[model samples]
Target: MEAEYLRHGVPLADYQLTKADHRRQREAVQVHEWVQRQLAEAPPWSDERWEEMRQLLGSPTPPWELQRWQLRLYCGHVIEATRNRNSPRPDGGVCDKKRCPDCGLDPAVIVAFEPLGPAAEPPAESHSLRSSRSTRQPPADRRSKAELVAENNALRAELEVLRDQA
Candidate 1:
């Protein structure tokens, strides 16, 4: 049956298709119908032309559902193939800048670049001390302690001088 043929011909399982796939399939069928109508309306064409049209309709190809599936497969393959190829080196954490290691793809083929920096390293104890010191504030009660101390010492010295005079 036609349904059986369509089911069998799909590269992926029927359940795997997303809603987008269904929409694409519907659009493809519409386009196919339009093409068929256009071909029918045109004046008698040569055998070669007819054959070409037939080929367009018959192959594992087109009518939208197949094209969408093919595109999905192609995209997935490219992503997986390039992922490892473009991965950064183990020692430096930097990916090879010149070429892909796995596929030998040119630098231009990679859409994004990721820089690998040094691996995790703990901060020194001194670093935490510096941070804490920078954030500390003086107690509210001792806010003017330095100035008060200086004033008290001056007053005491003056008293001692006055008492000496007495």
Candidate 2:
């Protein structure tokens, strides 16, 4: 349900959610904007960077997932109301009721997060380049994060040089 909202980008009022859901969706939108800004300015240096950024931030899922996850966490509990519109309450914790097969809510719930945890995005990714075992190219994953940044800068310089040459 939340995914449909996040994926669609339609206004929250379209979802027919209860008042609490509307508030939660609004909060999610804020989170979504912040996450997008982070994504745009993240390391600016690798395919794996966004994943790493996400790990530092909190979620590997899309902005909407985190938004919905946060909403569910906040709602704690929501009761079945008219026409499948669930009325979530701040108290009582609807987590148990969340188990219904048709409900489709997040399975596990977490409270807090640590700063420098595991890699948000794994290193095994291609940065717009096809993966090849060429000796001229070493996988960016093998290089330290510092090395990758330096390499990126060098590549940018080389690109400028090529453009001037052309």
Which one is best on lDDT? Answer: 1
Q: Roughly what TM-score does model 1 have, to 2 decimal places? A: 0.23
Q: Per-residue lDDT tens digits of candidate 2, residues 1-166?
A: 2112111112322333356555654565566568789989876667688678778888433321122221222223322211111212211233222322334433312111111112132244442233443435665569788988999999999999999999
Worst 10 residues of 1 by lDDT: 66-75
Determine which window of 10 residues in candidate 2 has minimal summed lDDT: 110-119
Error of 1 at 108 (Å): 34
For each candidate, the alpha-carbon lDDT, in order, equals 0.41, 0.38
**Runs in model 2 with CA error above 4 Å?**
1-16, 47-166
Error of 1 at 87 (Å): 23
